[model samples]
Target: MKTDQSLRTVIVTRYILPLREGGSLPALTEADDDFKYVLKFRGAGHGVKMLISELIGGELARFLGLKIPELVFANLDENFGRTEADEEIQDLLKASTGLNLAMHFLSGAINFDPSVMKVDAETASKIVWLDTFLTNIDRTFRNTNMLIWNRELWLIDFGASLYFHHSWDGWEEKAKTPFLMIKDHVLLDKATELRKIDLEFKSKITPEILSSIINLIPDDWLHWRDTELSPEEIRTVYFEFLKIRLENSEIFVKAAEDARL
Candidate 1:
């Protein structure tokens, strides 16, 4: 959407380096481009899941008021034969939004490791809160998915979130509170500041973005249900909850005080 201002569509050059740890393969785009992005393909018969996962992940990060890079759904014209599992997703977004939309290319943005920086407890607290709200269980010591850009922390690789959706019971747990990040939490000691964060950012969570995300959800993304919660419903729930939390940070503070007493 912001591509017209920030980025131009260019052919990716080649897979320069492979970040094999997280199933991400990094590549170089045409030489003139200033940014480099990662290309993630869909799994078998599960194109819908991949797209929805990105959409939900990005949207939730934005909703939580984090400094996340802009993400666009792209269509890679290069063909993998029909036997590949993600062919369905590849065909769908390509036809719908044209080939090659823009996305949050992480490499040019930040370093994946935070052990090298100096971050404090409060900032780490907010990071843990985001993980709890999204039910993301992957931000462990071994496989941290944080990207540091321009002295700020940006979140990435949320494929492991909403894990219960894939389970037989479906996503039944409501994400109400933020999680706690321990010393073992990656990026804890990194010298990252908690600036530019808008606890009140819920007000800016536009209807258009929410609609765009919901509209793109395919019919077969694992256990995601096309339930009664409309786009507006989801938007309202998120906004109201976020507003309450921001306006009432004191509520949590008081609870902590009472616990101490």
Candidate 2:
């Protein structure tokens, strides 16, 4: 969660175009700030929880010194959807006629190709550890979800990570659950120093940092029909779960190391 000083809110100025690659149907939108952003709708099939995951996952990456696009609170007016010719998009805009999440668009960025672009062992280890901590299942060889922008690798699309929140019945046990799918991570083969990376990060990510990151999530987004927990209570749950995971990161670190071998 970002501190109040770090969060920026922008109003949607124009709807540029739709990105058809993913199921969420994210749109390339222009904001009042005169900048382009990839807006993720709260009304998407994944619902507001997905936005929460995106907020946490992206901010966690930034906190760990990883490069990710800048995030903002985008305000979508009800009238913005009125001009859309597409019924589906109009419906989405209508449903999401409030605050949504947006990522600054990286113009002219290209998908990362591991064979052509070399990732050092240390960087790979850090990324792998981050993914393992978040239980991210989307950053595999098949869908990398990474881009080469300004000659640097940037992580994107974290709506699929932090999946434990989808089902809170046994979330405590699930937080410590082994991420078996990490074996297929795009950087797993190059992440040879998982223990070292884990050691470097374990202490840096304090409970305070986790709480701040979780705090960045808007209250409205945390309210879900599936559970009766209030927004603040839900934030506390995330903080506790992540703190427990940090304490138990050795398990995940060892798993990543074994997989690399």
Judged by lDDT, which candidate is best? 2
Write candidate 1's Cα lDDT for 133-240 as tens digits.
Answer: 444666766877777777788777666554433442222222233333233346444313222223333345344444444444433333336445654454444344
Q: List the global CA lDDT of all models.
A: 0.46, 0.89
Q: Tens digit of lDDT per residue, candidate 2, span 1-261?
A: 445325699999999999988789999999999999999999997888888888998998898999999999999988886978999989999999899999999999999998799999989988999998998898887889999999999999899888898888888887787788899999999998888888899979877788778888888787789999999889988988888888889788888877778
How many clashing pairs per prediction, in order?
9, 4
Query: Model 2 clash pairs?
Result: 1-212, 1-213, 1-214, 1-216
TM-score on alpha carbons, each prediction: 0.55, 0.96
Model 2 C-alpha RMSD vs. true structure (Å) is 1.4
Q: What CA root-mean-square deviation does each model show from the true structure?
A: 7.3, 1.4
Worst 10 residues of 2 by lDDT: 1-10
How far does residue 111 in candidate 2 sit from its true spot (Å)? Answer: 0.5
Least accurate 10 contiguous residues by lDDT in model 1: 1-10
Error of 2 at 126 (Å): 0.9
